[model samples]
Target: MHPATATPTHCPYCALQCGMNLAPGRGESPLAVEERADFPVNRGALCGKGRTAPALLSSRVRLTEPLIRSHATGRLEPATWEEALDTVAEGLDRNRRAHGADAVAVFGGGGLTNEKAYALGKFARVALGTSQIDYNGRFCMSSAAAAHQRAFGLDRGLPFPLADVPRTGCVILVGSNLAETMPPALRYLTELKENGGTLIVVDPRRTRTAEQADLHLAPRPGTDLALALGLLHLVVAEGRTDEEFIAGRTTGWPAARAAAMAHWPEHVERVTGIPVPKLREAVRMFCAPESAMVLTARGPEQQSKGTDTVGAWINLCLATGRAGRPLSGYGCLTGQGNGQGGREHGQKADQLPGYRKLTDPAARAHVAEVWGVDPDTLPGPGRSAYELLDALGTDTGPRALLLMGSNPVVSAPRAGHVEERLRALDFLAVADVVLSETAAMADVVLPVTQWAEETGTTTNLEGRVLLRRRALTPPPGVRSDLDVLHGLAARLGPGQGHPDLEKKFPTDPAEVFAELGRASAGGPADYAGIDYGRIAREDGVFWPCPTPGHPGTPRLFLDRFATEDGRARFVPVEHRAAGEEADAAYPLLLTTGRVVAQYQSGAQTRRVDELNAAAPGPFVEVHPRLAESLGAVEGQPLAVVSRRGRAVAPARITDTIRADTVFMPFHWPGEGRANTLTNPALDPVSRMPEFKVCAVRVETVDAAGRDTTPSTGAETADAAA
Candidate 1:
């Protein structure tokens, strides 16, 4: 049966936005989820998360009513949707009148579909006229996006589709563990490996991806820029660069070479811990191959020096003449399924749809005309997520905050500080499908539709765009995020916001998507050929799909760059230490990451009995020597404390990681929130905190089975706002 006539059409779990066919046979027959072949990127493969999606769609914990905390009684009560929205609208207006437009801020999520993302951006800038608006993508891809713009005058995550992977002769997998994170996308990597293509992996730990590589380089965290510079140093010093490619396709080679000379293999070996010999071998392998791809992900991009590190990696590709050609370029593997699309549709602080910068006069004029508003009326780039929270306790901070599909109290870098800020907010609203840890503390909770109940578009790690079809009606009382925002905008009056705002806001998502396409036109991420009709009729296509009859570009910079000189520019890099280093008092380094069985912050996966059973609780992996010294044994409780806060979890003895470091998953919060112990120091360029490195002390806890870590959700919700 066709999906439109079926019960559900969307994947329940991931924001990947892939399409599916749901077949229900009888009253009692279980529904089967088959991959919809028309889906662009996935084609038909489903990850473990995707396979378990349906259960999430039917979860009992989903919110289906409007909730408000009465100011008079100090109690939460169910209210009609109109009553709840009226309360929010009044509160926003009151706050705006008292504290001015900058006092209010909106925080969006990468999980929202393209249509919802564009709407959120427009609502914040046009409807509310607030400059303090940003999204969770600031934490995920800001650095990579900035790097792309700096290098190629564009911000296409991969600049090519996933189909190009199989054609590459060499693939450099840096700081990304695709084998565990997205198992279904591994076909191309596995095929390339089987066909004798060289696989080089670089990371701080021996991840599933690293262990399978022909060569694995375990550099110290945050020293990736140094390593990249060193590799380029070798490439240039030994005269192994593509001289013809460099001369014709790049600029600043001489200066970059001079900077590289200062970071020879021997110099970088001291910082990265990669031996000179091994580094040389990896460099030789990468440069010798005719077709090569360099990719980085969460690790390098989630650091204090993230953007510079990304720029250095791109510099390596430029020096080697590997980009703008089929199957070769510097690619960043995004963590969220829709991370690419979220940034593309103007959800970012400094951008408009189509990856156009907010600062670009022409781009701003185009969007302004499309929305019938003054270009100068839109706010400039805003503070990033970490900075936004930091601004909360200060006089310069935003007083009222609207959080949509994000749980910063649990997921942000500093849990204690975030909680403090949330409490201090003059007004706070949380829009989510479920009652998350952050939602529990909200003054008002809006029931928003989940993926299976919404329709729109999403782009994958590659630049490919695909449609998200609605399968079931949203649960009673729940609405799409766009609809919720529109309702609130209408109640606030002149939802278009400024004196120049158009007469009304578009209710049709297709119209909103069309505006987004036009915003991207003539920009680096042009999608002029795509529309709702085209997407529905022709599966989906990758961008820069510029015009009709024009085939979408599979790769970028085939012959030249977008730079004024028609050449890519190289930026020199230097190695920097992690924000916090191990000291005598705090003698061990702590690093955090995700477990294959769970997703970020465990808002959804933790609710599933089967998934929770696979990894029931958080465990700290320590070297046997460290565990013994602390009188801790396997499954025994221990307290790991940093200067900021502490967490107590079961101990697991493992040598898979370096002896100097302890590994923990960032999924759990409350009593054992990794964020409590994580430092909040920011990288100057990207403003991303150092989640991968910190200093901590270990001690045994006598509490036995009683884990004292705070529960981030219901309990807090009951006690707080």
Candidate 2:
């Protein structure tokens, strides 16, 4: 029973997946979290969010029983597990019967375990017979993933381990603020500096992470594409291009080089706000080293042209011959906890298990064989995350929805409109640990177990699959998401008038993982060789382990790229304007991101008193220039209006951000919901929403919506240091 004392587990917040131990708590707390030193990633350092994660386990804050919307009162009330499961099943079945199987949709999360993600995808295709399925992860790193696949012919967050950071020659960090988002991981960069490696941070804000960089490039929001192309331009002009490696290990260098040549230093300087001299310095630092790496996060990815932007960066790496070698290559700093594993399984709309393309006949046949179904019987590819959510309640869209582990109301771009779409759905069912803003609208809300109360596997950003053991039994009336899916699958499969459901989904995480492995065999993210026993024995096993005796691959592309010809493919791309630019009406750019004390959507962290004390609530981070123009003062409400929607939060005046941009933490709902102001314009390739940059106008106001001159003081400038 895990010794009834301490259970080693990984943090449930970000993709870093810091290791910790959960011991039995003395009083109301469910467990006490302690740092685990054996894990190579963090080395026993725990973030405040990880330390206070147990606070959400208390029944006083989270939902302890199933809730059903009453027909009479139009409000949610307590209900039995059986009743809630049956209600969800009937709701889904009724929608399918009326409008066909495509009328019912399923939305998943990035935090779910590998088993749950597999089962959830299976339940949607096999049990519900619907192709309308997607997940919130599309908002996290889809652009980087798309670009990674296009260039490397494979996508695993990082090609090497976090330990490689210290040994690299130079590391270019794009958009990610690891010091605040992933505090423990900041040590890797510190060690890099200690090891005499150079650090370049590219961000619009002079964040806590930017302060540590040897060189900081502050480009305008959504201008990352221009910045990347400009760097490549300088590389070509300075004759830093590795022609030998380009001819030996890469393809399509001619078109890529020619496209980069068009963007001169002066033109790029005009396009992006970065100076020409600073651009040359970044290129010199990057090319001076024998081996260097470029890592990107949400900054460059959450845009309408995210794929091409990431591709521009990859082009620079390939022109310099940094990829497919030790201490080098391009990598993505995925934000979700299991984002690596989540997309590897079938949760993504266009993918089957093992990162296989849904349209590929061989992939479909392999997975269908594992599921005991005909290959042609499975539905074709479906809509992307934002597309699926936008289509909800429409004539050609889904009428009923089943959601788990995500809070789209607070997280989705253009959140106000998303809420309207949710309200229009014929039936909605949500399963989460707490009654998130999205869960509050569900006709049936299922209380699911949290991280400490469950046993599962999560693949970190390093593509290392680790196990999280159950530290304690969940409170009464709470069940795991897999169990809920299993119960609903039984009710909705081959019963009443509906038939065709032939597969049985197991509730046990281990059994589900075994099935997932079998289904994923021979695919890009092959996991056939990994098992629970091996994970415990190895601490964590890297993917593409096709057999029991074959050692897991830690550093991919060391020998050859995953492409058919064993050479990296370079696709030519040019920088373009943002989906929405700063217009006269909305003369400022608005960007959204996370805070240290609050995780995504603030569903769990907002409930923790400690985390709340550290970050009381959402606020608009306005630069001194913008604040002076708007007469905004700290601690007073400031309204941000966009073409999509309007939101307000207390102004936090600081000079850390760009003069033409404002920052907001997207963890709260109501007036402070940053997603409400974000643009839903998606990338043509990745379908990632433009969450990072959108045009908005800010005005000083009171806590109420009424405009007013905020109280003037000393012009507070305290933000992330």
Best by lDDT: 2
lDDT of 2 at 626: 67
lDDT of each: 0.76, 0.90
Runs of candidate 1 exceeding 4 Å displacement: 1-19, 25-31, 37-40, 494-503, 704-721
Residue 681 lDDT, candidate 1, scale 0-100: 79
TM-score between model 2 and native: 0.97
- lDDT (tens digit, per residue) of candidate 1 on 1-721: 2234554244543434456676543332234577767565566777666666555655376788989988898766788899888888877777878888878888998888888888888888887888788877777777887787778877777776676776788888888887777666677788888877888998878888787888998876668888988998898888888888878888777877887788978779987778999999998889887889998887788787888888888888988888877778988887776888888877777788777779989989988887777899888988877888778635778888888978787778878888898888888888988788888888899988876666788776777677766666666788878778778877776543443333345656777777778777887777777876676666667788888667776677777777777778877666677788766667676778887778777787776666788888888877666665556779977777889888878888876666666778878876678888887777777677777778877777666644343321222112211
lDDT of 1 at 450: 74
The estimated TM-scores of all candidates read: 0.93, 0.97
Where model 2 places Cα greater than 4 Å from the true spot, the runs are 1-3, 496-503, 708-721
Model 2 lDDT per residue over 1-721, tens place? 2236888899999998889999877677868888799988999999999999888888889999999999999999999999999999999999999999999999999999999999999888888878999999999999999999999999999999999988999999999999999999999999999999999999999999999999999988898988998999899999999999999999999998899889999998877778899999999999998999999999999999999999999998999999998999899998999988998899899999999999999999999999987788789889999899999999999999999999999999999999999999999999999999999999999999989888999999999999998888887799999889878877887663344343377778999999999999999999999999999999999988999888999999988999999999999999889989876677778899989999999999999999999998999998876687668778889988899888888899988987778899999998789999999999999999999999887878755578674422122221111
**Top TM-score hit:** 2
